[model samples]
Target: MIIGICGSPRKQATEYVLEQALATLREKGYETTLWSVHGKWVDYCTHCDYCLTNKECVVQDDLQELYALLTGAQGIIFASPVYNGGVSAQTKAVMDRMRAVVAADKNFFKGKVGMGIVTGGDRNGGQEFALMQIHTFFIINGMIPVGGGFFGANLGATFWSKDTLDGVKLDEEGFRSLKKTTKRFAEYIERYGVKDGGKQS
Candidate 1:
């Protein structure tokens, strides 16, 4: 299964593009799930070091479910709206709270295929930086990161939403990038299967 995580808080461009990305994967014979962080309760990591010993987070919330989905999936597509030249707080929270899941099993994310998508309000709204941030998390967790190779999609998928869903729909280049990224993602997973389940159970 491939899981697409949408870090947007609204039913806007970010979520729309992510849904399309998952649809593309589904059409390619991959079972895909869209996990949106919108309106979900996910606490920020407090650097308490609780999970380091207990092997779990001290606070319980929606993230508990995400942990399972992430580890069990063959691939992960982390999609976020660019915020201050980076991922949104919701997306970062998901990335940060993974410490507990990783603490429980250090290799849970090892060998998994991961990629990123970023939507921005402006043409040069640091979309690439936000995309890179997601890749950094994937690398730190031992997952293999994939991008859209060259040309238009050199940094995975990126959309200039212009702060509106309709605007994103009009982004021809963005759709092309999404197509390239998802095509590569599906092909990579099909050709070189993941090395681990990354599951806790």
Candidate 2:
């Protein structure tokens, strides 16, 4: 399955952007799942070493369910609204809390395909930097990071949301990036991901 993690705290541009990305994957005959952090109480990871030994997160919260979803997904899309030139705290929390999941099985995400989507209020508002951050995490987690390549989506799907859903919808250039990125994302999954009800090792 292809899973999208929407890190927006509201039902706004970030969610819409991820929705479109997931829709593109669905069109390619891939099952998609979207998880939004809106109004969800996901506590921050304190770098606690409990998981290092226990192999599970000690703090029980909304992120527990996400762990399983993320583990089962063949492809992952991390979409976040730009906050202070970076991903929202919610997104960071989810990323940080994965320490335990990794401790449980070091190769939990090995060979998985991951991508990022960042939405900014203004053009070139640290979107690339935020995308880098997500890609960095994917690399560190042993997942393969894919991008749409040159042209519009040099790093991944980027949108100028102007902090509004309608504003993002009007971003024609952004849609081009989204389309290109999602197309690449789907293609990668088809080539490397599980098939015929078999999982990739």
RMSD of each: 1.6, 1.7
What's the residue-level lDDT of 168 in candidate 1? 98
User: Could you give candidate 2's per-residue lDDT for residues 50-74 as a string of tens digits?
Assistant: 9998999999999888887877788
> Tens digit of lDDT per residue, candidate 1, span 53-130?
999999899988888787778899999999999999999999999999889998888878888999999989999999
The lDDT per prediction is 0.90, 0.87
Q: State the local distance difference test value for candidate 2.
A: 0.87
Residue 191 accuracy (lDDT) in model 2 = 84
Score residue 4 of candidate 2 by CA lDDT.
96
Candidate No. with top lDDT: 1
Kindly report which residue stretches of model 2 are placed more than 4 angstroms away from their true locations once superposed: 194-201
RMSD (CA, angstroms), candidate 2:
1.7
